[model samples]
Target: MTQTLPLPVTPLTAAQQTSLVNLVRRAAKTEILPRFRNLSAHQIDTKSGPQDLVTEADIAAEAMIARGILQLFPNATVIGEEAAAKDPSLRQKAAEAELAFIIDPVDGTWNFAHGLPLFGVILAATRYGRPVFGLLYDPMVDDWIIADDQSPTRIAGAGRAERPTSVSKPGALETLSGIMHYYLMPKDAQAKLAPVLPSFSRMGSMRCSCHEYRTLAQGGVDFNLSGILNPWDHAAGVLLCQQAGGVAKMLDGRDYNIAIEEGYILCAADQGTWDTLKTLLSPLYE
Candidate 1:
């Protein structure tokens, strides 16, 4: 397989750019916000099991996004989380497409359905499997953390400036704070990593990758680890982290690719912290 290089990206025009942000806000206002804590039993369905869920809000928001993307960029492929769940091949198609918009309409479905404000919407624009732009939108706060090839990561909202953001500084492993969502890992891998949790000053999972990435990009956390490597979940986050002067790679130390799923991924504040994290987690996969 050939490696995909991060080439210079064509920046979206001011209108085109704002359209993406508006898409997220529109979905949140029309589809997501109305259903938060308001979903009925009929509105929820299990994908793999009880812990793996899909809600009406997810479907509605994804549909809205998909429609909007096709309308705005007719040539661009739109691969949404819910749609890809129904047809796994769409995931592969998106990775291979020349221009694609990958959407995670409701990233933290469980939290949203349960009235938790931890959920968010994620959008990633990829050119031939390499992310060129990423957006993580928090509806509760109506803020967006955005990153593109042309600029550093930044936060934008109604009353706030588009302030540049970066990752937290690297710290000793024992003093580092980060997120590790262990439940998504294989049983044996979980067992292997269980004893290593105490090595970090703080080790927890927010059950929300969107927020996890937000925490990392805004200098709120040192690193983030995950065993599940879904494109919708990590593509935008990883790009945002990288643009924020952080390092993100597979546990095996390869750069992240949307085509690969099912591996450990570590995104950290800096190269040193990334190396330390990979060293600590290598044993689990070894």
Candidate 2:
């Protein structure tokens, strides 16, 4: 019962913020938890290839989140994976929205369908197309990783933590070590990265960038590297990272803008890791 006030309520009342988070969490519990691992073969769909997957769980999860969010904020725009894929206009709206919910109903849809417990819900609020608040909830773990502008919160059932999470400094690019999640990058890139660091490990594509980002923010992981990822994938995660005293940016050292559909994302625990990664990655882009 360590009760404290939620921080950085900018454009939202504390009540609204709590309500929004509860709504997303409820949606996940109602629409996603029951369906996890209950999928038939037909419930799965191919997006790019066998590796890039979607399932009925993903669509159902998105719908539940969208409906719940829209019910509370009627004027609030919503950008979801299934909906955004069907209508390119949603992407445009996301880039221009003042207040909106970016939803990834079942971030690790593949894991969910396969009876793995790695997936979770990713929901974030954005103003003028910039992320402001984020929540990543894992139902199975009964944990919620939340990010407001002022602080990061990790709540599991009755327990919660409000603290800043950061990374170690950059030493040598050749000896750098961190966690990487390659969505669709070739394995060769993973192998080549070994020489760039003492450890460059891969955390399989769980489809939930929010969870990965939360892990980084909490110091559970060092970094997350991804190629061919969209804003919906990292919007909430990046915001959480910032709140947790970490940094999430493009490899080019630019702020990650939600205006774009897809780009490479690099998450580091602190400025030190960021500087090291930037120096090492610079030549590769050339």
Give candidate 2's TM-score.
Answer: 0.85
Candidate 2 steric clashes: 2
* Index of the highest-lDDT prediction: 1
Q: Which ten residues in a row have the lowest lDDT in candidate 1?
A: 5-14
Clashes of each: 0, 2
How far is 212's C-alpha from truth in model 2 (Å)? 1.0
> Against the hidden true structure, what lDDT does model 2 obtain?
0.71
Residues 19-45, candidate 1: write the lDDT tens digits: 999989999999999888888999999
Question: Per-residue lDDT for 189 in model 1?
Answer: 85
Instruction: For each candidate in the order shown, give its overall lDDT on alpha carbons.
Output: 0.89, 0.71
